[model samples]
Target: MASGTVLRSHAGGYLVYEPELDTVFQCAARGRLKKERVSIFTGDRVELDELDSEQNTAVITTMLERENLLSRPPLANVDQVIIVQAVHQPEWNPLLTDRYIVHFQLELSPALPVLCFNKCDLAEESELEALRSIYEPLGYFVIFVSAVTGRGIDDLARTLANKVSVFAGQSGVGKSTLLNCIEKDLQLKTGVMDHEFGVGRHTTTSSELYRLSFEHFPEIRASQTASWVGDTPGFNLLELKHPQPTEVVWQFPEILRLAQDCKFLNCLHLVENDCNVLNNIDEISLGRYNSYAAIVSDAQMEYSRRQVTSQKVEATVKKVGGRGGKEIHVPRLSTKYRAVSRRRERQGQYEEIDTDDDSIDDSLDATEDDTFQDGIVGQENLD
Candidate 1:
């Protein structure tokens, strides 16, 4: 038996790296894991059997307990996220940046996100300084680097050391370029951002873990710096599992701290007369405030939609239970069919009524005739 962490999941198999021997084993997971619907993902520590040291291969038999897991790309035990942003190419969309923050906040526990501004050489000094001023005060480490000039690559690499780090950012933000610059041996393929659209093509199609080398830095030991970094494919925007509307405040640390002073416990800060967020500061940055508002509204809309959908799902058409649980889909009702049902009920009632009006009239006429005959017979006897 051997132990290894899955470095990457490939076609029907995984690339497992064993730290004990600094070796990699290409292995397939046990069949039972699939039957149980347990997913095998990258960064999972697994127990391997059928080991062949000579061939560096094995079969994974057990998946160990995970520290955490991010279901979006299914990476486990991620220590931190490096959110890359190009300074100028995509025009530094602050709303997009805010959205990315909200993304990891919901997905990653303890939510460690370091905002990295890449391609700084292409942007103005004022632009970079603004981000540093805002985010640094908010307890976020903001790294300004120029992949083209190899600036701040060392600092970025050192930060990722002794931690499992993953890069996330918008397309064309130079995510791959930054990694390529950090480790020359990686030589990751980087795509050029489109001049017309200002968006970068997807250069890295999949997420894969790459080992970081500190051999270049004599002060840093390669053995100590031995760590893993995963570069995922860039996206225009990540689909998010929205937080509750009231929960959106917690996503913004600066605002959340001030929100405690609000008069209302559930202050969204938009229409609150006594919002501490507004009282504490004249106003949050327009960009930040707008993003906050947008997020809250989006969340509220999603919550409403979910409630409606849940109501529909709960309104069962028919339940076949206690006899081999079968269900029939309830069909939706419309006015036309409802009217037809009512009409059929009325027609049935009409048919059930007795038609006795003609009999009653004939009985009345017969009684009158009998009275007349009796009167004539009595008169004859008197005479």
Candidate 2:
């Protein structure tokens, strides 16, 4: 079997690139893999069997272990996730941006998160400085680039060198356009901004990894390191998984650091006394704090919902043996519908005997009295 990396997955099959031969093959997964329900995503290292050299086709037999996998765009073994946001047109939204940062932090903890703000040409110098001031201190690598003017493209390209990166952001933020500027050969489809709705139209519908070439950029050409990038479909709404309210602080590094100095070990930084985070709130940006508050609120609600659901499950469901002796949870039967045990039925029968004996005795006494009265009446009639 030959080893290769999956570059794309489509309805037809996968496109696997064999680095040893520097050859690309159109391949389908083995039937056994399909039956096992193993999913193949872009950036997955796989083993190919049943090669047809003439047809340039093969069958993917095995998927190697991944370093990390992201479920949102469904990419594997990512080194960094570069969140591409716009500086103007769609308008830079801090809340949405923070959500993206927190999402990557939770989904792919090992991978680094970089912020790349596109359309810098349209933004003022103050705007660019303001962005850097907000994110740079947070240990995030920030890049201001304009695909139209090609400003700061080199810096962006350097960051991508020798890494498997993913470009993700809201629709119509120029993710595709920026990539095309870096590598003109791609010519990825670019969408126009919807002036009516003030959003960018969705152009990328799926995720696909592309090998980057720096032949035009003389500085990076000497390094000769291979760089792969995946362009994923853009999205606007991001729903975070339910985490504990206290755990939400971990996503915000600034708050987490201050929380360590709080009087309470599990300080939420809200209205708690001696809360270091709240005491030093001025150090944290207002926008970041607002985002943190919103996320914590959502997490609290989700946690409550889960708690109620668990209680209901415990109350109404019971474990029972199934056909093959496997245990399963079934709904508990109501009291009126439950079967009575044989021992209990016998006990009830014994309890009713005393009441039956008393009724028989009373009937016998009444019969004796009636007989005496009848005899007296007959004797009087004869006289």
Candidate 3:
């Protein structure tokens, strides 16, 4: 068996790169892996079998455990995420940028998040300064680069050295263009912004990991370190998840710091009295605060939704023995409407009571019986 890293995944199979051999092989996964529902994603370390050197093909038999994984781009074991945005053309959106930051911060805990603004040549110096002023102080490593002018490319190259970095941002923000500029050999496709829509057309349709060598950047040539960069398809809509209402503050570093002095330990900083975050609101940027507020509101709604869903599930479903003696969740019937088993009826504990008119209890029992039958059908389908 041979060990390699998955560089890309497609409908056909995957492209696995073996570091020791310095070769890439077109590989297909083993049948057992598919049967087990083991997903093979880019950047995953996998063991290979059935190697064919002449055909440059192999079969992936095993996948090693990943250090981390990002669901949006379907990447594993990423060291850092560079959130790229354009200062012009497509335009800069602070709220959207913050959402990405918070999302990665929550998903990739302890992994660094770098902010890169592309198309600097189109933006005024003051505009650039304003961006730096907003995010630099918040401990974000910010870089202003123009792929057209080659500005800050050296700095960006140096930061990416020896790490598996992912380039993520809005489409048409010049992610592909900047990467092409960094390495002419890349030649990744670039797109133009739509004049009417004010958004860039999608150029990168999938995520692929590319090796960045020192030869690409003269400044880092002496270092002899190579980096791997995953160019992911750009997206406009980002949905933040997992963070609870109170935990939302943790994603905003500045607010989290100020929240320490709040009067209530669980204060959400909206309108709570003696809230230090609200008291010192001026210290936080209006844009950042607005993003925080929006995210917190969303988180609160999600939390309420989850609470209601869990309660509903608890009320409607119950654990019961399955065919193979395994416990499974099955639809539960209300005690009031439950049908007495034949064994219970056989005991003759109570006499059968007959009513002249149709009773509400009988109707309810019939409805519940139908519902129970439907639930059984759903469970069987799931099985």
Candidate 4:
């Protein structure tokens, strides 16, 4: 059996790359692999049998242990995340950038995120430095590159060596363009596999790993380190899962530090009296602070929204009948929403309906009293 790493997972099979033979082959997992409830992801190492070196194909018999897993695309054994963001055009969004960071932490990714600013040629150097100042202090690797002019391309390329890095950030931030610039060979292969090989474009939506070679681009990386990159489509706008209300600040290293001086241990830093974050707001970048506030609010709000949805979705089915037939009874779930569920909670409709009913009853009572109160009877004339 030959051992290989899965470079792409789709089409009910995989493109496994065996370094021993220095070749990539199309392989499918054993039928029992699915029965065992094992999921195969890109970047997974597996044991292959029934190898056909001539056709460059094989069957994956077993999957090896993984070092880690990435969120969103959910690739395994990720070494780093290249957080690419544009310097202009769309403008640098600090909130979205920070949100990605929090997403990484929430996923418990062991890899460090590399902050890369693309389109440096369009924006000013001061703009680039401003971003660096915030994250550099937190021990993040920051880079500025222009896909047009190839600025900082070689530097960014060198750092990717020996690491299974994934490019993640907002769309239209020049991720594809930048990658194309760094790896010229990508142009030769735009779409997925061809029909003859039964390896057409990956039918699955899972992320696919592309192997990087020093031989292809000698100017960038000299050594082959099993380096691969996964272009995580739709992962650009990473939606964070619900986090605890108090756990939001802990995600921000800068804010969490000053939060120690807050009057309350659980201070959320949003308009709280004597709040250290608000009191010393000038000490931090106002933009970042605003971003932080919005992130926390969004996380909390998202959490609340999910909770309401879950509560409403929980349903109990009841079957009632004798021996003839059975009736499936599904009870309605409570739709009561929390005060925080909405921006402003309004009064219930029951109270308004009751008030209107009471008013109508009072009018009827007066009408009845007046109709009977007339002592002079005109009913005899009518008869």
Taking the tens digit of each residue's C-alpha lDDT, what string does model 3 give over 1-383?
Answer: 68998888644578899877788998777755554445677888999877888898888878897777776666888889999998987889887788888777765765558999999999999999999999999889999999888899988988888889999887778888988877788889888788787776666777889988657667677775657899976643423443667777877879988986788967999998768999999999999999999888877776788788873212333568877898764434433235768887765333223212221111112221132223332221110
Per-residue alpha-carbon lDDT of model 4 for 316-350, expressed as tens digits?
12235647776533222112211224323233333
TM-score of each: 0.77, 0.78, 0.78, 0.72
Ranking by lDDT: 2, 3, 1, 4
Rate residue 58 of model 3 by lDDT. 80
Local error of candidate 4 at residue 104 (angstroms): 1.6
Model 4 earns a TM-score of 0.72
Lowest lDDT 10-residue stretch of candidate 3: 359-368
Residue 274, candidate 1: how far off, in angstroms? 4.0
Instruction: Report the candidate with higher lDDT, 3 versus 4.
Output: 3
Candidate 4 deviant stretches above 4 angstroms: 108-110, 188-206, 216-224, 236-238, 309-383
Please, what is the whole-model Cα lDDT of each candidate in the order they appear?
0.70, 0.76, 0.75, 0.65
- The residue-by-residue lDDT of candidate 1 on 1-383, one tens digit each, is 67888887654577899878888987766655543334666778899888878988777777887777765445777888888888888778887788878777666745558999988888888988888887888778889999888788878877877778889877678888888777778888889877887777666666677777765654544545457788876543324545768777767777777886688866788887757787766546677878888988888887788888873212202233446666432322222223357787686456434322211111112221132233333221111
Off by over 4 Å in 1: 222-225, 236-238, 279-283, 311-383
Candidate 1 or 4, higher TM-score? 1
| Comparing 2 and 4 on lDDT, the stronger one | 2
Candidate 2 weakest ten by summed lDDT: 359-368
Candidate 3 at residue 327, lDDT? 74
Query: In model 1, what is the error at residue 77, expressed in angstroms?
Result: 0.8
